[model samples]
Target chain A: MSSATTFLLTTIMISFIINIAISLYGVFAKPSLVKKFIALTIFSDSVNSFAILIGFRRTPLGYPSIAVMPSPPQSVEDLKRFVSEAVDPVPQALVLTAVVIGLAVNMFLVGLIMLYYKYYGSTSTRRVKI
Target chain B: MSTLQDPLTGIAPLYLIAVAFLTAALGLVIRSNKFFKVFAIVNTAIVFAISAYIMHKVVDEGIQLYFFGGYPAPLGIAYEIDNLNALLGLLATSIMLLSGIYSAWYMNFPRTYLYYTLFLTLLAGSLGCLYTGDYFNFFVMLEVLSLSSYSLVAYFRDSPKSIEAAIRFAFTGIISSSFYLLSAFVAYASFGTLTMADIALKARDLNAVTQFSGGVVGNVAIASAMMIALASWTWTFKAAIFPNYFWLPDAVPEAPTPISAVFVGVIDLIGVYGAIRMFYTFFGQGSIALQFRSYTLEIFQILGAISVFIGVFLLLLQEDVKKFIAYSTISHLGLIFMALSLDSGEGISAAILHTISNSFAESLLFYSAGIAIVAVGRSINTLGVLRKYRVALAGIIIAMLNLIGVPPLLGFWSKYLIFKAFLDTGKIYGVVILVLATGISAIGYFKMLFSTLKPVEKIREDPRLRNSMLADITIALCVVILIAIGALYMLSPSARKFINEIGYNVIEGYKAYYAFLSSGS
Candidate 1:
């Protein structure tokens, strides 16, 4: 890997980690339910992005290709090379599923929070009694 | 029984998934809650039958594998059935079946079709958690299970307490599950695969490749440690251990009693199973994660011991009957985790056995607590109302004794095994923790038992409470199963041997676990 490319990648990865940390702090330290929900959204999407980073790969052509077969390979060597060049589909599929689930859970929690507000007229964490 | 049934292991979970959606669709078309309840009961019965068949097939054969889309391991989703998960399948199905039957009489509110739909979906998600052979599948199912549980917790949407409990449960649940998902990412990034058995094989033999990709590509030790740290937090929360246990006591007491019973017995168990899968199966005997695993397990042991003391102390101070039972459950789960952290064959087996008996015992208490407190309200002082209902009184006694670890009862042997495992591991403090937790929780148990003996006349005039034959039958059945299984454990050698083998095979049977995928590297 070239030094410039390595430096750019390292900086991007560090920022991803920082984003995750900040979102988690928001989730825990924020007092309002809506703000906490927003934080949760960022947290999950950040992790989903992290997953894409895991499965992402580059091709010899300087740009990466997905796991899909662009064209049929004729020889065994061709198929083997195709496998090596393509990005892993598993993590992509995983990220998609995680994002969908995160959406559903976020919707559910928000709905619950709305109901909670109707009962107490506030989304602040202080109003919820044990 | 026949060659045609070879693929039933794969078909069983799919059947459960199909039935979950079918139950949802049935609720929409059929507006009658009675019809919905009966449909759910029948569906649970059939699911139980399928699980029994899978259990039989698994015992006759060894591990069974079914690849989705006929794609080989590591490239497609897989369902691997070994002795451990197959046994859990039977346990989960049976618990839900009993729950289905009991809930028929218990749930009287309108829009109860929604409740039944969520119930079946919870069962489906729990079964998926138990039966799945892939990491991503497990994460998705955990979400399914958590979402349903959160909804069910706040099923009484009008009540502020239910909403409060649901919020606490949901926030912790979502965050914990996301952490688990992150661990899965770390795993896939380093291992180049997400299939569990493939990961297991490669974790032990670093150079081993799956059918689709080469394995252990980068920084295996750090990745494994990260996965363990992330996954254990989720597992501990799901299982309701210390520091992560805030939601359980609140959630259970607010939800309807049958849902409370199922939550304690079935839903929380997914975490224990996940921990075993990671520590014993995936991160098993070799790989470079050994030092990190041992260090983390020690931390887990300390956490488990702390939870035991914490649970018992809080349990004694509880004023509500249902919350008392939930606290008792937390302590039992603490015992299970302590056993799990011991990381020996006997420890795992004891953990598994304790889980079964604890589920039955806890559910038995919650089922009987229904007649004891619901009509009168949640106060523990009203347990004297239970005195008039002879069956509930007996159920409470047996259940309490079972939890308190009376000799020859169902809970005793599992507790005995946990203690023995602790002693064998030279962790004398674990035994001290066990004995102290049991002794302290006993005070709470006896308080409940004695309160029932008092002369409270509030429930004697309630006619609606006297006519619940189905609920009584469920309670009686739990008592009988508890005594029967305990007796069978005492008298039958094969039953004892079978449980021992499951505990033993969980860690040692890795070779056979992956042997089904002969074509995979």
Candidate 2:
């Protein structure tokens, strides 16, 4: 609702949009197999960014709380009481799981790509299906 | 206090999942010795018992929810159970236990041990997905299921085709997970919670942030929701529902026969379950006024319909038994999706029932096809003979009949229900599409059957082919279990009520779900 919170939200959304476009471009245009993997990484990063953005919060002093332990409030007048409510921990947990799974998928593919190179001596998927 | 939770029969879904998880962990460490098979079988047996316990609870006590660490509703993670999931959990465990037994007879020791571990892991992930109450946990559990499937697909890493299939599967898995996570994030941000009950509670109060007159949050909300839908679209592909289905038959065949059976039979069933859970539990029923109506529901319906048509059409073109069955899966899944999009109680119930029946039929088809291959010592097209291989051919015939939805088989009831649901809803066009699809499926199945049945003029007995006693027994058991269900369906109203009671409220909440989603509108 405030100007600063809106600004931070816009920044996160823009980054996410850019990452999505990059992944789309890779999916549609990239010829090399490894490039597609790189593109997938970029795509995953954007999703992770989206998760982080959901947890972004601002302090009562009108600045974004970069990171802090959400503490017990001393008084009702404490700005920290109003503004410093901890960001949703669920997204953080979700993103962590996604990153680990992403790593496993990447490892599997890298192994496959190496095998593909040995068999065909190329990384392009164009001729492989036929 | 622990006794109050009812330990033995009123077993939690998590305990069964933990049994699977711990079994997989144990197998990984001790896989070098012959003891691996014994341990794996024992582990699966334990999981089977746990699933049976959950099933008994559902049949007797109704849906059960367990919060980890004893946190109450709306605050802690909950494993909610009803008949739909209890049945699926039981079905998965039974199939896994049977397949584990069958694998010992049919599979080599080394591959058997490796696959058993991965198989249990995949089963755990699927069971977790079925029972979890939180939206984010659904996505996480889905990833656990998908990731294991990717590994299982690539288990035959020595083969290029298998590797390629695994890669594509992983790519699609990533896409689906992203879409699912994105959807969860948007729903959470908008509603300030991830629990389904809370989301439903909160959905009624919030309005879409409107800078102007229309209820749009500018570019922010649109992108978030689109990302979520895109993830689900990837699932549509993974489930082999028409256009995105090039991977199922090709990659699946390259895996060993038992693994292929689980992939098509159980794993794909889990994918369909994920879609239903997302649509009904997360998004509520189909409401056009909800944001992204055209993209989520309409586009999904069109995709589902196209998959039904194309799947059957493609099946009509395939002569190979496995490939034909693969296409049959796409067509059947299309019908399921059609029901899902319709979002009626009957439609959802029919889809759930159809899911189990299709899984049973697919397992029979794949296992039978494997046996046929072994007995003939060649592919179906290359093999010439029906009378020469009567038992294997009979297995194929029974499987084909079920796949084609011949009356009194497992497939027939589900098809009847799906068509009836469409007819009841006055979706005459949907019924027509289903009828036409079934017709084409019948032709496709018959073509494969006819190829297998072609008589050989001079039959040469091959000793190697005759040694497939284990494969024959496995197929016979699958057929018998399927037959047992047909009579059971005829004999019980309480049995029918068990399934309805579990999935009914999830479907009934559609109106409230839509209200929550459109409150801002």
Candidate 3:
């Protein structure tokens, strides 16, 4: 309901849109293999960031955005009390795994790219026609 | 005493794992040409022993959880061996051993230790991914598998297309891994657990924050988990799903037949295994349902149909014998998925049977292709590669026929089961599409065979190239074994029951086992 919560949510959604646009551009327009690879990597990272953002929550007090479970403390005052939970951890773990997988994939791509360059002396996607 | 109590409990399997590690180490240390032979044989044997032991543990004791240094599941890394993993582990080892022996004679160049080292490492990486319970450990193993495969795909660095294909394959692999990790993060955050069992159990209770109409809808917790669950489909690209299948046919052709055999034949099995484990065990009844909601099964069904159609269509067009077989592999996987998407007892059983048979038939295709190429001293495209070598061509033709689901062959029985499954479910459209795909694929297989029987041009055959009578016989022998298995499935209900039980264990999860246990009780 608060202004800051609204602002954070909007920011996350906009970034996700931008990520999709950039990835589409790279996949469709890029003439070079390396560029497409870079674009895909960026797109995946952006998506990962969006996943983390979705899990964010904000409290009435000055605390980090997080999720809150129901069932308040015993007293009425305790029930009204708010505390920030950390943002959802699931997306973050998924992102961590995705990033490492991305890196390994990048290393493999780089090796292939170098091999391609050695064989054809060009990184352009159109040049290496099978 | 704690770690080494029962014979089946821990000690033997651990020793076997050590032996597997030692084989990898030995492959690294030993540089002699002759040493590669020894290394390949010993390494494969050791891996087989380890897998067999693990498989025994899984069947007898349910999932086998091995915590290192006496640490338990929550605190330390766990190697979980359920039926799904146990099957894949056994599959990886057996195929690696079979194909490794077959490759010794098939590879044109001298047996360098590099080949064995890369081969064994690839085997280990795949097995590790199947067994490890922790998400992080699975990622690490996947990385090792991807790295090795990338190099193997580009091993014939002489061709630019090979490099290009590898690049594409690697990029796709990275994207898949990224999605996988993103999903993993989501699951971890949602449940605060990394252990597969715990995560599966905990993810179900996740309720979403109630929001306004325009805001985030549904349970936020479930949404996050679903996003994570769906991310894994990225790896389906690596698995050569319909649209993402471009690289497999091209990349697979560029590798040496043995490596190609491993890549197209065995590696995809690992992908299927990962998908099953993640979906069925970790996310099946838990977070996945919330995450996927209704679209998951529908999407899988659609993808399955497309892959089956596209793969068979492509297979029909393929002129290159190896490429034809590669396309067939994709088409077969599509059929497997179709059966899997059905999500029935019989349907799942059909998929598992198809997976096993296809692995063998595809490997046989690669092996025969290699032998014929060497014999004729050119690729399969050159005329008379098969006709000039009658015995060799016959062997490959039989394999190709087997591939096309001809009666009494391995492919026939599995394809039949899938048809029966669709019919049982009254999926008329699926049945029609499957029959059509099989009909079209038969043409592709025949073409490959046709090329083999054509007369040879007057190209000079190398005198020093020893005619591998043994290799030809081995190819024939594998075909026989495949046919025998297929025939066994036809005649015996017990074999069907055995396979069905394994499938039920895999696709239905603990529910199947619980039912069986209760009946016994």
Candidate 4:
């Protein structure tokens, strides 16, 4: 790999790892349910970015394509060139699905938190015994 | 085009999935309780029929691969139905049908139309998980299963305990699902394909090339191992294995009883099926298994043994009857895992049989316990209060006996098969540990059973049990099925032979699976 590619990969990896660490700390160590929900969102989003990063590929011109096909290449030569240059599309599709599922889970958690507060008159889970 | 017109191969699984999803969507708009109840029953019955037909097709004609929209395997999603999944799909749909009928009386809360909708969605998600051949589709279906289950667990939102359990369940569930997604990303990054059969083919080719160089101890090997480990962790969490099992006891008991039955009977079993499918079908070939087979088997073996011990130990201490049954589920699942870990034809057969028996037994137990709870005026802290309901008490006894593997019940034959598999593998330690676990669990089950049978001086009449005709019919249906299976096993050699064939099919289907992927038709 080139120096620019190595640098880009290293940066993405480090950011994903750091975000995951901090978010996990919030989810497990924090007592507040709302904080845990926020932390969960961060964790999910970071994982989604990691998936997208795996699909990232640098072209010969040193530009990264996001793997969304504009249209199928009509010519065989163009198809071969596109296949070599384009980023993998599968992980990008997976990330799209993950993002939507994450949003739904987050919304459900918020509703549950609201209900928990209404019932127990508190949002902190530390006092709630398992 | 004419080949694609084959009904059993092309549209059977889709019919099973679409019926549930459409019923759920229609239930939401209709908003009538009576209509929702009837719709859920009729819908699950249709799904059950389709599942049975698909299983019959798979047995007679062989593996059925249904590609959605007429797209082939690599380019579009497909539903791969072999004997293993066909049987599991049938088991899951049958339980859903019975529980859907029982829930007509069990779910007496206001706005029960929403319950029916969620119930159907959960069934659809499970059927999708069983049928999908694409890894990304599996992840999406898993999310659908988890989200609907989390909502169902908190359906009785009036109780603070139920909400608490739901939160914990959701938190653990999302974290585990993220691990699954991460594993998918790693697999796709390495293989450049999302279809399981294609991935398996590539992995096998890589293994063939690497075998001469050395065993697969390179970077690719490490990546594949990591993917398997991560995926296994997510599956174990869902299956409620030892370390990841804390949420199960809390979550299952808090849900309404019919939902509890779904959790233990359908959802947890699907989790085990996913793990088994991943190990046997997706990663059965190539460097991944070659490098990590022994280690993976040992990990599952030890984990399964520990879960068996801890689950039964916890069962002995539970005051609440629902929680007791939940812990028993964990213990039985551990046995199934132990069998699956052997990774042989006999072991897989044992696991499948146990899955069948345990699904029916656990659902029967939970529904019967639900009846006792209703008869005892909602909260059943002690078993003494159940003396008033003789009919439910008898059902509970039969169910408990089946769970304990007493003779002449379906559970006994499955447990016998598992023991035989352990002995066949020469895992003496596994056999000894399972025997000890079964012995201890029998004590706990008998204690719960006998207490329910004890007579009380003041026999109070419960209005709920007095009118629970539907629930009675459901429980009776489960008991009859259990007995019938047991009798068929004893009386017929062909029935036993058929189950063995299903097991061998799972073990031998890998070549055909790879052939289809490589053919690229």
Candidate 5:
């Protein structure tokens, strides 16, 4: 609710939306397959960032912490404090898996575009469209 | 652990996944075509038997949940076995088993080692998608299925058209699947758990199970709207309805014939299956999906109707037989979509039966066409060659009649149920949609089917076509299957009761479905 925090949050939110928009347009409109591939990477990365953001939560002390426990909780009070202070770990794990999948798909597509290039001598959809 | 999840029998789904890896490894180690053919066929038959055995267990014992890695529902992945998915599992394995035998001659082995590798992986991915209880897990399994299918669609790497279709298919597929991933994230963000049953429970009533989530979340209705909207885009694309229908015409013609059968028969049905699960089971009545969009289900009907119209008109113009079959797929899927959105148990069962029957008829047509195409070349104009092959001729006639929904066939009963379900729901326009769809589409069906009676301009022979005992047997098997299921419907009271029961469970079996989900924890 503080002025500085509000300013920071608004800026981050606006930029995230802008990034997603730019990446989407790139994927949809690019004439070159490789360019579209780049856009796809950014698009997936933006979604991954959103997934990571889903886990973000502020502690009672008004600071964000990673999903890891600060240390092994030795007491009930310690466990409760750790739970309240840390962000949710599940989305982070989900994002990790998504990242790996994105990499595999990207590599396969790049290889595919290369194959298409060999067959048609270009990666431009304009020239080699079905 | 639940007793139902206690046996080696519980690993029926896992066996397919492991076998897929085994097949992939075997391809690298062995170079013998005959060995791979027998091995693949034998493996598929065994899985088919296991699915049938476990399907009976599910029906008699109630819903079964098998936990992977022993980590209970919320923490680890789980597979939920129910009558609906059990039927799909049976469908998936049986179709793949039959396709294997058909492919024994269709695929040139040693050279097609990679094809079978991808084939088994596609099967595992489908089994995974059907059985997994986690929403995120569904996303992973869908990706597995899509990746293998993208490769298979471009199996003829020498052709630029095939590669281009594969590229477009891959790009569209990745983007659409990511949307599903986003839905899963939204669900996890809102429901505070990734387990599908937990999410369903939360969607219906958040306070019903307050144990897992003390986390912050969004409004259920708004969240459900976002999730359903995003997720259905993927389903529509997968089902090849409307705007997504663009890929099918291009992709189906380019792939080898058996892969074409896999596309129409096994792969497309999974899309309808996903939609049914998301709409009816995951977010059913009294959930935010109902309240958030006044016409969420109506959207299905409207899209279905347009897709049917578009598919039919296009089918009339397609010169390529494979592309014609692809358009027919769009029309059939649209009809299923309309049924799924209807207001009664009749709607759900009607959709399920149609999905089953439609896949059979469509695949049989493709298989029969394969025999002719390999001999005379791939064109509906060349279908005259089928006259010499009685099995292919019989296959085409029966499948076309069944697809056209001519009475006394298996396809007709499902179409009739869909009509009845529409009336039961008091949607008169549904009747208009059904009648006009069948009436108009039948012309295209006959135009193509009747081509077999016309004489060919010239004939070319492939020796394999003369020796296609395996394909002849496969076509006969398909023909027998279409007739048997149709006969059983009219003669057996149990058959009527069973299909009706599966339909009822689809619409109203949530309590039993709920218990299995929660039991995993």
Candidate 6:
């Protein structure tokens, strides 16, 4: 709603898009398995950040907001007002799970790469054929 | 009706998942192959029993909803079971049971405990995916299934090819799942809820409000389409549909045979189920769906047509038996997709029947192929070596016929229903494509049979074929079921009624689902 908030959101959006583009290029273009894994990690992190961005909210006072459990309010009216100011928490929670799953996948990829290197003496996918 | 007091609602679905995880932990602690084998079989059998009971309860008492930790549907995770999920749950558990039995004698890896643990975990994750009613929970379960499958594919760590296949599968699978997560995020942002029923309700409300106010609902429509597109990409990838099927043939053939059975038979079906559930239950009646339904169906039809032709052509070229079976699976999955894309009750029923029958046939094919491969040595890819093994060859022929949709087999009835669905819709192009694909697929199967059954001058008896009673029994059981189901269909009216009931339950069950959720029951 405000210029500062709009600018911040725009910057985050642009950075996230650029991160995804570069990571996707790396994943598809890189011949080495390790590079692809790194690219995938970056890609997943960008997705998580993008998800968090969707949950962002701006208050009437032109400040960024987050959803938190409000401590006791003075009245029901006060509680209603506070609730309207809070950002969505669902996407943030989803991002948390995504990050953990991403870590598990990345760790598994790293182990697979290690095994690949040990077996074929190279980490390049081009060199490994079934 | 009082919701929280109903003990049977929540506990039935959780039993399988809990038992699986408990057995997995026990496998880790004990590290004994015999102990884990027995544990896995017992747990899968129990899950199968529970699944059958849950199916009966669901059909008798209506849909069962399970909220976690006493929390309600919108706020906490829930598992919803209608006839559709109950049927799928039953199928998955039964396949896991058979696969477990087959693995007991088939799997000879040094790390048997780890294998059983991962196997059981995979089954649990699949069952969880089938049972869960929440979007985020479904994604988590999918990840569980994918991770376990990747590990299982690379189970033969000593073989470079298996590990290579696993690497490719894991990367592609992870990318697909990331897309799914992104779609879930979009859906949540649009609807502010992850529960499928709640989302459907809010989506309808949003559509109504936007239409009344003459506001810009284009953004909402675009978001819904984007979500569907993203999720469909993941599903098509997992189901080995057109343009995303490169990993399957490589991944499936390299896994151990029992794991291959699970991959081709059970895991891929879950992918199809996800697509159907998302499209039919969550988005079926929404405004966006109403706008995009025909377009989506067209896209699926085209893709399905491509997958069928390409799969059969590739199947005709494969020298390896496992790869051939994998290609056949892709072809059959394409047919299932086409049937589902018809978006009719008849279409859905046809797809479901095809799914069940195909699982049995494909798994039996894989098992028989594994036995034959063992008898001839793994390197002997040609079918000439199969001449000595008469029983395995017979099993393979029958299974292949089931796959080719020979009359009186279970496959024929399902295919006939799919064709009838096409005909009812007046989609002559779909009917033509289905007929052509079936013909080409039959040719491929005939080629395989001829190669295996042709007379050879000398037959060398392999010692490995001498003591293959486990595989023989497994194949025989599958064959018996395949023929028995076909015979029942031809003889009994109740069999047809049962299938139609499930069809109605899935196609017409969404309204009841939404109403129940809205009432907070």
Per-prediction interface RMSD in Å: 1.5, 2.2, 3.4, 1.3, 1.4, 1.7
lDDT of 1 by residue, B1-521 (tens): 12333566677556766776776777677778788888889988988998898888788887767777677767878888888898888988988988888898788788887888788889888988999999888998899899999999999998988998899889889999999999999989998888898888878888775567666777888888899999999999999999898888989998988999998999779989999999888877765788999998899898888888888999999999888989998999999999998979999989999999999999999998888765687889888888778898999999999998898997999999999999998999988888889899999999999998877765544554857888888998889989999999999999889888987898677678776555532
Candidate number that wins on lDDT, 2 or 6: 6
lDDT of 3 by residue, A1-130 (tens): 4677677678878877788688858854787877887888787778677767756656555446444445655665554443335454545655676666667666767777777777777878785542
Error of 3 at B223 (Å): 3.1
Give the Cα lDDT of each candidate.
0.85, 0.68, 0.67, 0.80, 0.83, 0.80
Using DockQ as the yardstick, the better of models 2 and 3 is 2
DockQ of 5: 0.67
Which 10-residue window of candidate 2 chain B scores lowest in summed lDDT?
B209-218
Instruction: Give the residue spans of candidate 1 off by over 4 A.
Output: A61-70, A74-81, B1-5, B460-464, B519-521
Please, what are the lDDT tens digits per residue for candidate 5 over residues B1-521? 64346554456556766877777787788888888788778878887888888788887987777778776676677678788888888888888887999989898734666787787888878888887888998998898889989998888887888889999899989989989998898888888888777777777776765445553276877788888998988999988888677788878888888888888888887888888888877788666677644477888888898998998888888888888889998999999988987746888899889988988998999999998888887777889988889988999999999998877889999999998999988999989988888888888888987788898767675668668899998899998998899899978998889889887887787666767554534
> Model 3 interface RMSD, in angstroms?
3.4
lDDT of 1 by residue, A1-130 (tens): 4455567668889999999899999888888989888988999988999998876665665556555554666788878777778877777888889988988998899899999889888889864532
lDDT of 2 at B170: 74
**What residue pairs are clashing in model 5?**
none
Instruction: Report the Cα lDDT for residue B331, model 6.
Output: 91
TM-score for candidate 3, residues paired by index:
0.82
What lDDT score is found at residue A119 in candidate 2?
A: 73
Which 10-residue span in candidate 3 chain B carries the lowest summed lDDT? B208-217
Q: Which residue pairs of candidate 1 clash? A: none
Candidate 1 is graded, for docking, as medium
lDDT of 6 at B366: 83
- The estimated TM-scores of all candidates read 0.96, 0.86, 0.82, 0.93, 0.96, 0.93
Residue pairs in steric clash, candidate 4? none
State how far residue B102 of model 5 sits from its true place (Å): 1.0
Worst 10 residues of 5 chain B by lDDT: B207-216
How good is the docking of model 2, by CAPRI class? medium
Q: Can you write out model 4's per-residue Cα lDDT over B35-60, one digit (the tens) per residue?
A: 77887798788778888988888888
Task: Name the better of 3 and 5 by lDDT.
Answer: 5
